[model samples]
Target chain A: MDYFFFIDLIQSTVDGLLFGTTYALIGIGFTLIFGVMRKLNLAYGAAALAGTYIGLVVFLMFDAHPALVFLASALGSGLIGLVVYLCCFRFTPSNYPMASLLASVGMLLFIDEVVIHASHGLPYPYPSVFRDAIIELGDVWVRGDLLFVFFMCVVAMAALFWLLYRTPLGLATRAVSQQPRAAQLCGIDVTRVNMMTFGIAGVLGGIAGAMTAAAVGVLSPVIAMGLTVKGLIVVVIGGLGSIPGAIIGGLLVGAAENIFLLLRGVTERDIYVMLLLFIFLTLRPGGLFGSAQTRD
Target chain B: MLEIADIKTSYGKIAALKGVSLDIHDGGLTCLLGPNGAGKTTLIWTIAGILKAQAGSMKIDSEEILGLKPHQIVSKGIVTVPENRLVFPDMSVRDNLIAGAFSRRKEKGGIEGDLEDVLTRFPRLRERSEQMAGTLSGGEQQMLAVGRALMARPKILLMDEPSTGLAPIIVEEIFEIIGGLRDEGRTIFLVEQNAHMALKYADRFYLLEQGRVTFSGEPGAVDHDEVIQRAYLGARKAS
Candidate 1:
């Protein structure tokens, strides 16, 4: 019994870590937009869901390849991101952060309603690239789809790092993030940079959405709100604007969630996750890697 | 040459610059001396397109440039070294300098050459190139701010209180740099509370009081002590 319990713990941890990559990808999308604009985009998950829904339509109608679906999802979501910036963030008075937050929440509900109406509030089958493929490591089993998600997440992060460090647009984005007024004096166009940031976040979200749907082998409107809540929890636990923090936060949340599921049950899992968030908030409000003083 | 005629700027209901007029001539340093709240920074921001002027005409060599954006103004070769040395603290000194050339990002070769030249001009910054700007001392930060503006290749440099909050020796070093820029035939519009250092380098000087230009003349034409006193105190007391 003791040996079996240890094996179960290890297996759960491995599974959680792999699944956490999806959460990290989603968390990164949130962090990137927040880093640049210093505003929460509550509609981020819904936007991703919208892209996933589009990908589902393409797959259903044309019998598209998995790669084509992911591509379509990214492009569709990227366009929606720009639209969200224009509608929810762009024209709002910059000083009024609450207005933008509320606007994004409104967008979130609108997108959820749209998706529900389009699909008749029903879940759709999402094709998995690595369907039924699992690797056996002694007593533990690893899903090939989850491993693929992990690999894709690493590739995405590496690409993100390269874009942020080696490109002019990335430099401008960092500059604007650090000191917006100074960036303006440096002749960096703040509005253009902000719009581009939103688009990038959207692309990331779409990929994450597609990956999550494939992992679950289903896509539904309910996933939109669930992902948003999970994404926010990851952001808060990691640190508001720290990229690395979001990744770690996602993994930590994932592992803790699985452990709680084993100790308690499915119904009581989120209770422990919320408890963990509260502990982090009370003891280390800046999160695992954030400075105490954040941009107000 | 830059011309400012009847430029009026306000902060909400409070007007900071009321019908302010001045001429910033080519290839010479024109200094504006004023007490606190005399609209010196306001004028600089307005000229740099960071602030809007309710009523005025700002012309650069006969082209109207009053309503242009800040980056547009920068591309026009008007760069500003803002007050309080606002550097991007989280970025390295080198990155800060590179960001200064954002307006001319397409000119790769020119940017590289300019970056080398700026580093050479401030060796201290070169030594701390990889260090974050926030970690630098106040004096070093001031140097970084000036170097940042220089990277923009400005035809007209608008400097606002470059000497504020620095050691006396550092202030002298900063003035020397400013004086060096003036000698290099750069058109400079300087707003300063340090009238003494400003007078040492200014070809012409203006005294601004309560949002208006109250006095304008060559530095040599005025008594240095009286002008310094008037700069610290309002013109009403000096009169």
Candidate 2:
């Protein structure tokens, strides 16, 4: 019995290691938005889930493959991200950064309500390619779909890294992020760069949302807030606006939650995750990769 | 040539420039000397279109540009090297120079040629091309700022206090570069507190105090004592 429990723990750990990539993707979207605009986009999690639903509708209408559905979802979410910026961020008085934050929170609720109404508060079986296929490594088994998700995560991260560090567009983004006024003086349109950042982050969120729904094999409107809390935790623990920090933080949170769930139960599992966030906030508020908390 | 008429700029309730007016020639060095809070910086920002003038007209070559955006000003051959060397600190020196030529991004060959010209003029920047702008010393950053502005290939350069907070040797070096720019047939509108150094190079001088122009004259005929007195200390004492 004890040996069986140990195996269960190891399996759950492996499962979390794969699932952590989804969390990292979600957190990266949040971090990129924060990095460029210096504002928290609270609606990102809800937007991601909404994107997944849009993908489902596209699949139903066209009988498209899962890959195409995923693509559609990402593109749709990118559009939504731009819309959110236009409605919530663009026209808000520049003097009040808090206004954008509060507005985004309102957007989060607005998106959530829309999703709830459209779905009638129901949970549906989501598409999961290669769901039953498994890999056996001695005494352990790995889900094939999870392995695919991990592979996708690596590809997306690499593409993002190239886009951010290697291209002139990335340079423009960095310039806008650091000194918007100086960038404007340099003849770079600051507003355009901001819009680009939001679009990129939105696509990333859509990917994360679709992948998460596939991994869980079900989609529920209720998980929007939970995913949001998880993403916020990842961003805080990873250090705000730090890409590598988000990745590491997501993995850490996923592993800790899995371990906690194994040791305790479902009711107490979230307590440990919250405790970890509190500990990081108290001990190292700058996060593992952040230098300091300077609100832009 | 740049011309301003009745330019009134304010911050909230307090007016920084109260109907201030000035003219800059096409190929001469013009210096604006003023005490702190006398709105010299405000004047520079207003001309650069960073601050909007409430009731005024600014013309560059007969084109009205009072309400135009900053980038538009740059496009129309007016560029400003701001105070405190406001270069992108994290960007490489080369990048800082490249950004200066951003308005001319469409003119690839011209930008490349101007870059080479700027590099030849400021060899120190060439040496530190890959270094971050923030990592450079105060004097180097100031030089980078000037070089960056030249990348725009401006017809008239508006420089605000290029010599602030620098050693005497560095100040001399900066002034020499400013003199070089003037000799290159570029119009320069310089704002400075160091009247002694400026009078040697400036063709025309304007002294501002309390958001108004107190004095404007040629270098040789101006009363130096009165100018210095107003510069270091505020208010001309009920005269």
Candidate 3:
């Protein structure tokens, strides 16, 4: 094999790994809420897309710094999450799981349409936080934007793990996740824990949205369907409620898709990814780290 | 001490407790004896704040406690070991015990000490501390539930049918533990269908029939044979 070909392979691997970080961030958002409430916010991807729109609007109108734009966008998405919780989840009868899921699906379409109407079907230019070019390694190069997004994702994951395993709030959240009735009996405010969990997930998703926009340098309504499908695939692949599983699953899906694209082209890439998902669902429904039994 | 007065609770239109009243003094075990569907669990739920009383009041140490959330009631130091021992099945036995003390904001060291004490009291729990609670046997789960409640350091522990579904030997062992808890000066409000064990361990007992308290007195005052017959057959022998 040519030395340059080997370098290209290493570069693509790094690129896949870097892109996988964003997927992991999105997966964590899904897993966080699912872990505690056992409810999937199907609109999660839409929420992130909505956040990107917010950042774009702020950057255009106020000429805000990238950091402020990201914060503003996250706040907007967080509010959307709160609304989703109230409208879609809060009042739905607890026993009606199907109804809740349908409501979330409805929410996804509703938000997507709103974004499309607002943006008038045009792809909006998104502001980048970093101005550096790709760093070269032999024949391989890593984009600065992708590297930053990867670092952000790692930091966010670390923070989430700390919040979940190290703090008192995390303990309370875990208690409610395990046994809502018992948690209530122990005087833990179950509703508050649920709200906070959703909020944190929304914030992470918002950051993910901004970082994704920065990575790609553009935002469009078209990305909603693809991102939503990808996020769902990640959630299923990672197991419904396992954090570590989400991270691993996201990376696996990212790298596997890249390798498939290299070997079989884009048309067959999703086919292989979907096949991987189907295989996991049939053989190891719990994902890699998920417990054998499904939790309610 | 706890006082429940004229509490009325219902499932839709059907009333479970209709203006029922009871009192439990401090530092003694009081058993509520009733047949199936006699509103025993309903009353327990109401007192524990899981079910709201439609009419009437509940007071703990003279503080009005009706309508408080279950956790709020727990913060006031009243904890219930619910029927069926609804332990967190997927969680470890240790996690279940930790969950019992969730209402407290105290020293970790002290909580650990209390955990150790509970483990010592229920050696079976110690043996299975790392095991998932769902894997424990019925008898061991009962012990785990009671042990979990004890970790709360509750001022009043409401236990519902702690001996239900246990073997006779396990039942005796559980009653012995209950007797020990009573001796340790914990205020216990027990709901039991097991008249023999209730009479053996409770300082006072209440008999609820058709959602009304038909009998309340010291165990010795109630004729053992009559109470047993009433509990099982819902009738008294014609003299």
Q: Candidate 2 on B150-206: residue-level lDDT in tens?
A: 998888898999999999999999999999989988899999988888888999999
Q: Which candidate number would show the highest DockQ if scored against the true structure?
A: 1
Q: List candidate 2 stretches off by more than 4 Å.
A: A1-13, A137-140, A293-296
After superposition on all C-alphas, the RMSD of every candidate to the true structure, in Å, is 1.5, 2.5, 3.1
Q: Write the per-residue lDDT of candidate 1 for residues B5-122, one digit (tens) a residue.
A: 9999999999999999999999989999999999999999899888999999999999999999999999999999989988999899999999999998998488989989999999
Q: In candidate 1, residue A146 scores what lDDT?
A: 88
TM-score of decoy 3: 0.89
Model 2 C-alpha lDDT per residue in residues A84-188, reported as the tens digit of each score: 999888899767989999999999999999999998999877778888899998677999999887777778888898998776667778777767666666667
| Better-scoring candidate (TM-score), 1 or 2 | 1
Q: DockQ for each of the predicted structures, in order?
A: 0.73, 0.51, 0.56
Candidate 1's C-alpha lDDT? 0.90
Candidate 3 has which clashing residue pairs, if any?
Answer: A187-B71
Residue A236 lDDT, candidate 2, scale 0-100: 90
Which ranking of candidates, highest DockQ first? 1, 3, 2
Instruction: Looking at model 2, give its docking quality level.
Output: medium
* lDDT (Cα) of model 2: 0.87
Winning candidate number (lDDT): 1
Please give the ranking of all candidate structures by lDDT, highest first, separated by commas. 1, 2, 3
**Model 1: per-residue lDDT, tens digit, A43-128?**
99999899888899999999999889888888788888898999999999988999999999999999999999999999999877
Candidate 1 structure, TM-score to reference: 0.97
